[model samples]
Target: MKAIRIHEFGGPEVMQLEEVPKPLPAADEILLKVYATSVNPADYIIRQGGNDLLRPLLKLPMGLGLDASGIVEAIGADVKDFKPGNKVYGVPNFPGDGGYAEYLAAKATQFAPMPHNITFNEAGALPSCALIAWNAIVDLGHVQPGQRVLIHGAAGGVGNLAVQFAKAKGAYVIGTASAHNFDFLKELGADEVIDYNTQHFEELLHDIDLVFNASPVRDQSVRMKSAEVLKDGGIFVCSQLDSPFPAALLQVLAAKNAIGTMVGGGSISYTSSLHGTTALIEEGKVKAVVSKVYPLAEVAAAHRESEKKHVRGKLVLEVAKEN
Candidate 1:
């Protein structure tokens, strides 16, 4: 088996595609012959050594991905929900086996049946970011019908999905994005779109019941300013994922009467939140928003594109086909 692993973290250069023994499923896991995977902010962050504290604790030589879509080649003795040839998608939290590989052995609970009508590429583009959106919008925000939901960075991976999820719940969705993506967000069910490059969203909208801050420093880290538009008792969930709150963010939230907290969706609980999107995918109300696809061997190029942060929707890794 050939998989990408890192001996040291710094840049995409750290990821090495080398021969390695294929993993075998544990008694509670499933073995997947990976068809596709995806690049995420975490992928780049981990490769670039941004997680300084976690880096020292890592096993040194470790795999470098989190989300994948594949076919079950074998199921563990205790696994009953799937069998050989079943298609699945999952995000197994890293520091474990990774997705940028030919095969993966992961806990059965981390995976779900891929929606029948979509391609492996689409499912591959989900898992990590989609689960984040699901957790922030559905779990943390507790969005309900007739609620007004505002999503920052609404054209990006998680924000795009957040818009759809909010719409599915009958909330009036408003999104902040560049002028180029205004129409795109509208197509995703955003009732109104604000061009963050030119307009201030908080000035234009108020009484928002929920605000999912998906922007990573765009609008200069608006978590605090975002509270200005939220209704009293509303929820504001910021995704500072795998990092501490942008300095003084907690203080700003503390001053508000609304429920405000950052969403750390990369944990094991992300797998459970994925189950919610699985339902929406099956209902055909939600799907991947992939903007590009690259071969598995070109993962470095994918990382570069993700780092640019202008990628619409998501970027996918075409694996089995590349092999």
Candidate 2:
């Protein structure tokens, strides 16, 4: 099996596609012949070692990818929910050899049946991003219908899904993005879209019941501003799992009596989140937002694009064709 592995952290150029031994299922795992995977900010961030302190913690020569959609080639003795040839999609274990390979052997609990309404490339784009969005809006925020829910970076991978998920939950969804994406966010069910380029969101909106910061941009200013718009006793959710909640932002939330929480990639149940997203997709209430599809060999190119931080949706890597 060929996999993209980075022996040392640096640039997208560090990712190399090489012949590697195929992985086998563990006692509670499933071996999947991956049809596709998607590029995420985390992919490029991890490829470059995230930061100085984190760089030392990464094991060199690891595969890069968090999402996968494919057919089950085999299952472990302990995995009875799926059989050989089942179509599935989910997040593979992070900080390990990932889904950017011809095959993956991951814990069966990390997966769910792929949404029947989407293509392999689309399914590949959903798992990690959708899980993050679900965790933020559903689990942490506890958004309710008619609540004013604000989402930052509404045009990005997780942001777009967050908008849809919030909408499906009956919240009045508001999104912040560049002016060019205003229409796109609205199409994804945002009741209102603010252009972050020319307008400040805090100045325009108030009494927001929930604020979800899903943007990849690391500006603490967004966090402070987001804290301002929340209604008293509102919820503020952060998606930057690796970063701590700043004291200033915490103070802002405290002043408003708003709750502040951070969501991690693995903080929620993968099976349940994927199942919820699948239900939405199959019911036509949600859609996969794929920006581009790259051949698995062009992973380096995809990384370059993801590093730009301007991709509207996910950039997918085609690993194999569904037969």
Candidate 3:
């Protein structure tokens, strides 16, 4: 099987596609004939050695990627919910095995049957980002109908989905993005959109019930301002992928009587998260938006694009033809 593997941590160039032995399903696992996968910040972060803390725990010759959508080619003896021909999508054994490959074997519980309404291209990108959005907004944020919800980076993968997720719960959703994406965000259910380049969001918005700071961590000021827009008891959700939530930010939340939340590895909860996202998709309340599709060989270029951090939606990689 052909797979993307990195023996060294550096730039996107460090990832090399090579022929590797295919993995077989264990008693509780299943083999997937991979059709598509998507690029996440974690992929590039690990590639660029930004996650040095994890390096000591990681083995060499690791594959890269966390989301996949494909047909089940084989199932282990213990697998019951899935069969050999089922179409499935999810983050399988995330942070351990990568999904960028012609074939992958992962625990059967790690996957859910693919949403019946989408193609392989959209399905592949929905796992990691979409599931995380569901967890953050629905599970953690407890976003309720009629609440005022503000989502930073509302046009990006998690933000875009978060906007819709908030809306689905009947929240009044506001999104921050460039003026160019106002219409795009509105299409995705943002009730109000702010141009981060021109407008100061905190200056104009207030009394938020929930805020999802899906923006880059480089903008440290944004986190503080996101906290500023919240009502006394509003919740501020930050991504743990980049910066840790500083103690000062926690103090700010405390002063406001609000909560600062950063979700971490809940590998045990992934199956439920996948099911939540799938239910939303099946209900016609959520849709996966992909900005670009790259051939498997052009993964390096995908990393470059993702690094730009302005991608309107998720970037997908077609690992195999959808036959």
| Tens digit per residue, CA lDDT, model 2, 38-150 | 99888888888875534655787788799999999999989989999899999887766778999989999999999998999999998999999999988888889899999
Residue 311's C-alpha lDDT in candidate 1? 83
How would you encode candidate 3's per-residue C-alpha lDDT over 64-148 as one tens digit per residue? 7889999999999999999988999988766656689999999998899888988999999888887778878888899988999
Off by over 4 Å in 3: none
Q: Which candidate has the top score in lDDT?
A: 2
Query: Whose TM-score is greatest here?
Result: 2
Q: Estimate candidate 1's alpha-carbon lDDT, on a 0 to 1 scale.
A: 0.83
- lDDT tens per residue, model 1, 1-323: 99998888788888888999998899999999898899887788777775754565467678878799989999999999889999888886465467899998998888888878788999998887877888888888888999999998899888999999999999999998889998888888899999888998868988889999887554435776788788877888887654556656556556667787777633536456777788888898987898999988999999998898888898898888722
* Ten residues in sequence with the least summed lDDT for candidate 3: 49-58
The residue pairs found clashing in candidate 2 are: none
Kindly report which residue stretches of model 1 are placed more than 4 angstroms away from their true locations once superposed.
Answer: 218-221, 242-255, 265-272
Q: Report residue 93 deviation for candidate 2 (angstroms).
A: 1.8
Score every model by TM-score: 0.93, 0.97, 0.96
Better of 1 and 3 by TM-score: 3
